[model samples]
Target: MKLKTYDISLVGMFAALMAIGANITSVAPFLQVAGVPLSMQPFFCILAGLLIGSRLGALSMIVYALIGIAGAPVFAGFSGGPGVIIGSTGGFILSYIVAAYVAGRIVERSQNPGLPSFYTASFAGIVLIYVIGTTYMYAALNFWMEVEMTYLGAWGIMSWFIVKDAAFTVLGAVIAPRIYKSVHRGARLGRRSAA
Candidate 1:
């Protein structure tokens, strides 16, 4: 599908949301796991997918990543620049695009997607985010960083985060459909009135 001005605005909005989600609470020790800071990027990323569809959702994530890489200070802990891409959490940042696309693709497949579809898509998104993020963190730590960590240990370190992300995923699924319905209805009415 071709992107219009409205789609571009939505993409920009989600990118801004990603920035806000990243530094929502600053970089507190309690919010960190294995030196990686926790952020709501997944929640917003999945929401973009649910609300806007796979292409625009992935586009928004790409915009967010690019902005961060350009030293916009839009990343987690208010840190940004190309160096962050080489950092441990970079995989998570990159995973946003994949997770958003997958999540949106799942929902788009349904003729009339309901709560079940949303839940499945959101869960899948979260799974992808964790899998990609954790794998990259493991490699970054063991190889370049000179820190030893088993694959299982990497997964174990992210257990708490998985729980937290699971909750946010459910929340996104619940709210997204309602918001989508409202927006769809409004758009339809606007067309009818215009005609």
Candidate 2:
């Protein structure tokens, strides 16, 4: 499907927002819960999905990934480059596209994109991200990086992030519908004024 200029802008905005989210660490840097740094990207990913739907949401994430790989320091800890994309945490970064797509697809399919829909989609999407991320992490570390980590070990590491991700999921679910409505309403008004 072809995107209008406004949709394209929204996609770009989400991509930038994803980058900004990665850089924000207001909740104390030294806070260590199973060696995972808390991040806001999960919330932004779900917001993108809910606002833009599957295709645009996924496209936004892809753009974000490209920017980070291009050395924009958009990734977590302000790290970026091809090396980062191929690194151990790369799986989680890459999974953002799939996760957003899944969440957006679910919301798009729902007749009423309300709290229940958002909650379900967010939860499922987060789970999918973990699944894809954990599997890729295991393979990348053990085979590619030669770091040697069992599948369970990789999952164990991810278990720590699950709670943090869940919190973001809830935030996304609560705020997404409102933002989606406001954005679309503004789009409609713009179209009307132009017409």
Which structure among the candidates has the greatest lDDT? Answer: 1
lDDT of each: 0.88, 0.85
TM-score of 2: 0.90
Superposed by TM-score, candidate 1 places the C-alpha of residue 34 at a distance from the truth, in angstroms, of: 14
Stretches of model 1 off by over 4 angstroms after superposition: 27-38, 185-195
For residue 43, give model 2's deviation from the true position in Å: 1.3
lDDT string, candidate 2, 1-195, tens digits: 777777788899999988877867643666555667677787888788888889999999999999989998888888899998788879888989998999999999998789999999899889888888889889889888989888989888877788888987898899888888888787677667656
Alpha-carbon error at 184 in model 2, in Å?
1.6
lDDT of 1 at 100: 95
lDDT of 1 by residue, 1-195 (tens): 655556777799999999998987674457665655667889999999988889989999999999999999999878999989888889999999999999999999999989999999999999999999999999998988889999999999888888778888999999988887775565456556656
- When summed lDDT is taken over every stretch of 10 residues in candidate 2, the lowest stretch is 26-35
